[model samples]
Target: MQHPAVPELAHTHTRPIHWVATATAIAGVVALSSLLQPKPATAAQSATPDAKPAPTTAPSTADVDFPLDCGPEQALVVKKATGDLDGDGTPETVAVVHCDAPMGTPPDGVYVLTHNPGHTHARVVATLIDPKARNTVTGLTVTDGAVLATLLGYSTADVPSCCPDVKDSARWQWKDNTFVRSTPAGARSI
Candidate 1:
């Protein structure tokens, strides 16, 4: 059977069609993979607001202030103490930090900061944050490689500032690289 020669039909199955077909197939595969593959987590999607970060350096060696300097607008200082409790041939500064909330007598916390090696600034060694409600460190002393923090707890919110109904003390020892709390003078732990 003799057929008529067609100039346009010869190019129909040429390299251009093959290239177009290959490109379409690649595009289809890419689209299908994008739909089926698990989405990569973005910063906002994976971010955890309540996540506490692991300590990068030893608390006894970190160069931070005891009060944490949480910015003046948010917090304030309530009490301060100075002595050597880490047995590192140096004195440390202990401070009680109080947050500024819209209530009567904010809760207070305790921290220990050491004087910098060059006497330039103080660096934090340990922290006892948010010890009790409406309470602050009544007294603190660093001796015998121990930190004796006297915390005064209040029975009611409307109690006097000086006389707390309950007087509690926490003792911390700088063991190895961290602070370990021990039993106080009249405390029994289970």
Candidate 2:
């Protein structure tokens, strides 16, 4: 027969329950961490309206005049003038001048002129190049009574030489009660 002390010792040596409790606590911690983790952003949250369009600047018409040396031999006459280049209700003028030199020559070439009121001044816009021949003027148009003239010069690949490529354009509009450069098309105001 087992002694009374043997029964007591058996009860005292119960399997350690700490390992099961520890495993359960570790599982809970893992689940909580997964629930708190960051999530991917959605389209609505990522989208923002920060970009904006640029404001347009009006052209200046302080000094308006055609060059003195403008002729078939030296300058180009107004070839086809339509839609008020000066923005006056009257039709605008256009001219196509021929050069005595070749395509790549640095002679005065084609141009368009917008006459100012009182016949006092004329705005002369032209396409020209330096010593190296290259198309310097690209966009030549009239908008809202202003003459927009663009000058796009030689490109590095176009000119093998080290000449600087100059790209610029001008706009003419009326200002100070004078037909400076800003005149809406088809309306003549001297």
- lDDT for each of the candidates? 0.64, 0.44
Instruction: Estimate, for each residue in 102-183, the C-alpha lDDT of model 2 and write its tens digit.
Output: 3443322334544444444455554322212443334456566555545444445655333436555555554553344332
| Model 1 lDDT tens row, 35-82 | 898877777545499754433322342334445334454656666666
Q: Model 1 misses residue 139 by how many Å? A: 2.1
Model 2, CA-based lDDT: 0.44
Model 1 vs. true fold: TM: 0.48
Which residue pairs overlap in candidate 1's backbone? 64-124
lDDT of 2 at 43: 75
